[model samples]
Target: MLKHSDIWRAIDRLAHRHGLSASGLAKRGGLDPTTFNKSKRMTPDGKLRWPSTESIAKVLEATGSSFTDFVAMTGEEGDGTGGGAGMSAAAMRRVPVIGYAQAGNDGYFDDAGYPAGNGWDELEFPHVADDHAYALEVSGDSMEPVYRDGDIIIVSPAASVRRGDRVVVRTRDGEVMAKQLARQTANRLELVSLNRSHPDRSLPMADVAWIARIMWASQ
Candidate 1:
């Protein structure tokens, strides 16, 4: 059962996960810094003032947080670390993990890009509301500087894709790559290479099999 306290606590957890204060999270969402301040949670008469849905929407969008993540942040309150924020143990799960090289193989993912075949490694990770979330191990210099070899990135196919977000894309020919999304048109997608040594790509939508947003990464 949801309660008023749960909602406020969720907001705090969200801010904590992002290594921000209530005021900082508000600023990041383009709201007044005091929007989530403790004082704002109550009226001058001492009545409870719930957070607006619009505010929640903006913060989620700004943080690139899936609704599932926000929902997971609700329910409990415990001491969370500052700056190096992490989810509670109960919110962690073992997700399918695959190497970047193996990710392009046909037997690994379904047509929609969800993990399918066996032989995948498992990694304990933060709660991603989408059950289809998986991890990919990096292995090359193409995504250097930002994502070096040996790093792991979590991908969420259920999350919304937008310009400026990092993403993993699989082409019809079975080529898989990660890049920052720069632009998207009715027929084309423009991706910015993580490494300057690698040229950016502009691909027709017809060539794309599937694309998923990078929700979390172990840097």
Candidate 2:
């Protein structure tokens, strides 16, 4: 069962883990800065205030944290490092990440390098330049242990996506996927999954939408 104190404690730890203040975390989650403030944690009558489920969900999305992790944050951690102003502004200017499964879909990313629409589920990360940036979420168990479902991956568009690099690719018909780049012959690219349970696949160069080297993951 969820309790008010547990929720507040989790919020505090989350801010610390991300090196953000309560207000900074709230801003990254697309909420009003006061949403996670100490004063907001109580009512005018002095009753303990609980964070709303929607707010919690947004915070989780923004921080790339799971429900289990949030629960584990109940124990107090030390005060997080400061520089909230700089980091918050830097975060706002950085490239955004989205679920990996959505990359190849035509409407998900635009030619201008901006993620299409405001519909993306986002994660807060240290600033990354726009040209070398992209975000993808892990899907399925094919890359398990190394990458898990729901892990947000950061891709460097400026980095050369060569053979042997882990990459995010799109199929001609609009399927997005992540796998290790294998062979790159004249007309095709081969990809392999980390999990041996899945067979390797070869795809024609013409069938790909975009290819970029994966830089890091939140997992």
Candidate 3:
């Protein structure tokens, strides 16, 4: 039996293989840009919203992928011998992890928010599904209750972030912070601290280096 997750995984893999985001793939296929977005994968009532055959066919044609390739990506090819064993393993990737202290240090990360130089530790985080995924280890109690010391958070620069999403933001002045997104606009961003001890902050968007959504956290 084909699972809804299986189909979506195939789409995600297809997009990644082509170096395109789900929306980008959709756009390339002449479909609405949000057709394959994560938010559209499920209905408002929490039911799975399976992609239509027409959309799938269009995307396959756009990317020059065949239906057979899509099936193999779903991990349903072969003689059903390996089953889903390889799927889980293939989904995971070694993510570079750095302590919050080291994150603020120079040369630890590049301009695009990717780990650049050395001193990074590796952690086997379960499928972030984003090429720009990285981990940050919390070191202080500034974000306690929600995120305590030693907690590892997986961030995805490729993920779409909205209000209420936990985010990691770095400023051009060298300030890096993890906070809940309160608001965002053309000129500024407002962030709220999980810990009441720290006051909410508002910064000019121009001063922000990069802002990535916190995808997952290891408590």
Query: Which structure among the candidates has the greatest lDDT?
Result: 1
**Which regions in candidate 3 have their CA more than 4 angstroms from the true location?**
1-87
User: Pairing residues by index, what is the TM-score of model 2?
Assistant: 0.60
Compared with the true structure, what per-residue lDDT tens digits does model 3 show for residues 1-219? 779988987887776565344655676688986798778889999999899999999999987888988887775442122344544657668677666877777787789887786544455555678866887877678998898665678889888899999999998877889999999999999999989999999999999998999988744
Off by over 4 Å in 1: 1-89
lDDT assessment of candidate 3: 0.79
Minimal lDDT window, size 10, model 1: 77-86
| lDDT tens digits by residue: candidate 2, 1-219 | 767887887786686466455655676688986797767889999999889989999989988888877877664442233333335544543345465555656677765334677544344456666554756656567788777654557777677667789987766687776789988877998999777788788999888767777887655
State the lDDT at 140 in candidate 2: 65
After TM-score superposition, the amount by which residue 28's alpha carbon in candidate 1 deviates from its true location, in angstroms, is: 34
What local lDDT does model 3 show for residue 133?
86
**Greater-TM-score candidate between 1 and 3:** 1
Residues 101-177 of candidate 1: C-alpha lDDT, one tens digit per residue: 88988888898889997655456666678899988877678998997655678899989999999999999999999
Tell me the alpha-carbon RMSD of every candidate. Answer: 15.7, 8.9, 16.2
Task: Report backbone clashes per prediction.
Answer: 0, 3, 0
